[model samples]
Target: MKKIGLIVNPIAGMGGSVGLKGTDGGIYKKALKLGAKTVTPKRTKELLSYIKNRNEINLVVAPGKMGEAYVREFNIAFKLIGQVPEETSAEDTRRIIGEMLNGGIELLVFVGGDGTARDVYDAVGSKIPVVAVPSGVKVFSSVFAVSARAAAEIVDAFIEGTNLTEEEVLDIDENAFRDNRLASKLYGYLMVPNVKKLLQAGKEASSMGKSSVDSKGEIARYIVENMDKETLCLLGPGTTLKAITDDMGLPKTLLGVDAVYNNRLVGKDLNEKGILRLLKKYKSKKIIVTPIGGNGFIFGRGSKQFTPEVIRLVGRGNIIIVGAYGKVSKLDCLRVDTGDFEIDKLLSGHIKVIVGKKEEMVMEVRC
Candidate 1:
């Protein structure tokens, strides 16, 4: 049997819905204080359900909430590897990985965001391929699959002898990010299954050329001009969407979702509960978002504040996607990983994307 290493970061993604941006450092306590919940368990469960060759694989997992708890529920043949403390740390991750590697795990599949990837990279480097399931607040790393289900597809391909490629392990300093500055750097590389369309590309920094700026302004103009007075607008994160707020002279959170109504900022850095409250107050609403450059993700990338519930409440017709011409041209299609299979299916189709003030194009969105 092909041996596989499975590890879960129990606290991954806890800060997303609470507007903490990430759970790194002492921010995890702040996230819990804001009523953040565990998302990694549910995410890992979804990924394991899609494994078709479970009989051919032996999963070596860590103890308790780290790995064995979820693996046991799935009935997949797994061996418990190591003990985990009540509160886990990066040291635990590295130690568990070392044990798994010594046990001859062929491929290591982990569930977390950029931080977990860095830990895995430090332990294994490119010695064995890895499949990362996105369960953290900011999954800017290319080492992760676009979604949990996609991670399963990549694992199946790995068992089928698919070729592997070295993908960059990149992460940002969350402290700098929370301070309204982006400081992304390449940490290392990991060998990953080269499954086209199943894996996501690394996030690219926004190009600040004059034309890019001009295009954002045009797109912003179009959205503002077409705004319905009675509707509440949920502006997602990214500089492209920030342009709209800039044109309206409204303050915006660079990495959190904001709410606008009648060309005014209603709420900034809202959480899931905050959004639902706003949705209840406004009968008419729309969500305006821009794709993450090089990744083509309009939703389910870094902004988990626009949860599946928020998307369903707004409805698909009320969703407006905008992107700069340069960014849109570089992408094959847009992607979404909302963790809701039904919702994902509902969103999979050709949709209209506004690229400029008067320029709109039809593009396909894959789940």
Candidate 2:
């Protein structure tokens, strides 16, 4: 059987719903105090559940909540690699992955986001191929699969014999991220199964070229012209969406959710609780969002504040998608991974995107 290793960063995505942006350093404790829950467990279980070639491989997993907790539920053969304390940290992730590598694992499957990807790159480098499950808040790295199910597929492909390719691992500054600045640099690369269709594209910085700027202005003008003054508009994060607020002469959180009512700034940098409170007060609500430039994700990437409940309350009909032609044209299709399969299914299908003034494109939304 092909030997595979599994590692889970238990505290990876605890900060997303609470508006902490990332769980790096000591921010995980703050996220816990704010009622953030463990996100990697469900993601690990989903990845294990969807792996069709379970019997064809043996798993070497880290002990406790880091890995063993979820693998025990499955019938696959696995062995514990290293011990971890009750409260796990990035050091635990790095140390355990090193042990797994020394144990001669042919491939590794890790569940977490950008930080976790960096840890894996530090441990594994280009030694063996890996399948990265996207479970963390800022999953901007191209090394990750689009979703857990996709990660499972990548694993099966690796076991079935696929070529390996190097994917980038990005280092994101959590402190700068919380302060409304996206500071990132290329940390390193990890070898992954070359299943191009299953992998996600790395986040591309917004273009500032003349054509791109003009396109954004046209989109902002068109949205403002057609906006309903009586509706409460929840604007998702992105410079493209921020252009709309700038056009209205209102401030916006560059990387956080904001609320607008009758062209007035009602809320800024809203968390899940804050968003729910606003949804309760207003009956007529609409959500304006722009997809990530390269990844084409409208939800479940940068803005986790737009939870499944929030999307349900806003309803599918009230969601407005806006992007510049330069960005939308490069994407194959739009995607959404709300962590709830029902909500993802609800969002999948054909949707209209406003690219410029009186210009719209019908794009398919894939779950």
Predicted structure with the largest lDDT when compared to the true one:
2
Per-residue alpha-carbon lDDT of model 1 for 214-295, expressed as tens digits? 9999998888888897899999898988999998999889888999998778898899989999999999999999889989
Worst 10 residues of 1 by lDDT: 174-183
Q: What range of 10 consecutive residues in model 2 has the weakest lDDT sum?
A: 11-20
Per-model TM against the reference: 0.98, 0.99
The TM-score obtained by model 2 is 0.99
| lDDT for residue 23 in candidate 2, whole number 0-100 | 95
Q: Which stretches of candidate 1 lie over 4 Å from their true place?
A: none
Output the TM-score of candidate 1.
0.98
Highest TM-score model number: 2
RMSD of 2: 0.8
